[model samples]
Target: MNIRKTVARVAGVGAVATAALGLFSTGAANADTFIPLPGGEITQTLSDGTVVTIKLVGESANISGSMGATPVHRNAWVSASAQVQISGDTSATGGKIFPGYVVGCQVTIDGGNVNGGASGGVSWDNSGNATPSASANSGANLTLGPGQAKSFYVLDQEVPDDYGNESHKTRNKFTGNSGSVTWSDETIGLNGCAGYAQARSFVSVEVETDNVISWVTLWGQPFSLG
Candidate 1:
């Protein structure tokens, strides 16, 4: 009886392995690169009144100068536009929230001054009289269930150079007569926060793109109050 049982188990194991091989030989298969323990999406957009959820993943990011002198690195960033809706407080200022790269990942948002550049934002008031301000870098720590661990490096800071670049920092619009050109609301750690100006607000949303992994384990479905 013992011999029979041993042979049966061996045959079953061989058969299972063979089946797995056959499946892989098929044309295509859906596979995940990293499996989040009870995981899900990352990209999120939050405003004074609304919240938008976007599918996102960690991607390598960096910033360097024309001479390669200044270099700032970040784990990842939001690839493109994320949806947003104002919260209950219409006048409440907003800020960008970035889930830094891997918890252990060390990163930085160069925060260069591109205030006068073509791509930089126009101008705005910074006289402390209700000016629009916000930014996103890359990190955050979330608690799923009781003790369930999920941590991401995040970059969040008060806008020091609203419309300025590393080249020329500190340009106040409300207080100064510089036409209040326009503040670069997008706080990109890689560009040192250099970008063509656009919409002005206190809230910002960040996300990651291009996972490039063999497996991606999703957490739970997104939970939003919006």
Candidate 2:
């Protein structure tokens, strides 16, 4: 049947401390599995004495086993909030929040940070100051075979640029001491993978201060996409 789904977004309302699981459908044979995830947090101090903290909260997922009634098709809905905090006397000004996910088909994606890059399911840097890679897509719909994986951002905001031209952005820009972005019911439709699949969340932030500019990223626990 070639079932397809579209991604949805909603404005964030800060971080939520409590989360729980729920069901999607009442049918016994085709009911979706709801999972409440324990999101993650990270704190890093920049060389210029600026502090950056990133958090992923209120994460959950609803998974459908067979989207198109075929073994090669799967789909899921994910929700989460990405929050950033900047502090220090360096006059840390503003930053950008890039929230995304990596999906793997029959491949292990628990390798942690991949040389401080976000390519080929490698994840963010463990040192907390690696520059973010520019290899992420802006959509959630994806396709992969066994031993393959891909990463994509959650935001596709359209706005006017400096020249008044239409611009598409994948990251939320925030100014001041704190900023946050939230999304609900984002769709992830996969195809061509007949084996087990998995997905993990990531929050990458770019911090800019009067003295220096740096990046900090936080990775979430991986979960199945059955």
Candidate 3:
């Protein structure tokens, strides 16, 4: 009877262990490993004590591919929206605020014709010639490896009192009031790119009157592209 009891106890323990392993496997299979990015809100106080705030709304990406070439190339199109608000003691002197969206893209390829499995690169462009500084607007460029490429696109820009001139330097002006402006569905597209790619959205602001500039980037969840 003692031997029989011992045998029963061991069998029970084995059953429990098997059940626990099954549960663990099921949990692991059901768990999601992806993490989403956060929408961003940034505020900056100008030199003249003017408070400016920028907030990101919704952002997304659409990816496509072309099959004609020896090395398959992927295209990613990105879109985003944001709002900018200005307040605080603008009565002293009227100020102008330039607000716009910028999209930056980075791509990585494996054993492709581009980088030969080297690191990829990144690049940037602005729809409006607005820079963080008071000088001429200069875009950003980056080089990446492991078969990678990057580019930036400028989305819709709001110029408060734009007279529809050829000058790209247009922005929102606050004569003596507090207000906000929101943009929706600003889009940028990239083509003839290959490999895994991701895009980021940014809200660029320039306070012309106060000579202050700030940038708010929305690093929200990156979408996958073929």
Best by lDDT: 2
- lDDT by residue for model 2 (17-102), tens: 21111111111126778889888666677777777767777888888655466767777778887777888766767777766777
lDDT of 2: 0.62
The clash numbers for all candidates, in the given order, read: 58, 0, 15
True-structure lDDT of candidate 3: 0.31
Residue 148, model 1: Cα distance from true site in angstroms: 18
Candidate 3 — which residues are off by over 4 angstroms?
1-38, 65-71, 90-149, 156-192, 210-221
Q: Write the per-residue lDDT of candidate 1 for residues 33-76, one digit (tens) a residue.
A: 22121212332222222222322222111111212122222111
> Could you arrange the candidates by TM-score from highest to lowest?
2, 3, 1
In candidate 2, position 147 carries an lDDT of 75
Cα-based lDDT at residue 24, candidate 2: 18
- The Cα RMSD of model 1 versus the native structure comes to 24.6
Residue 139 miss distance in model 1 (angstroms): 10
Each prediction's TM-score versus the true structure: 0.20, 0.79, 0.45
Q: Which of candidates 1 and 3 is the stronger one according to TM-score? A: 3
lDDT of each: 0.18, 0.62, 0.31
* Candidate scoring better on TM-score of 1 and 2: 2
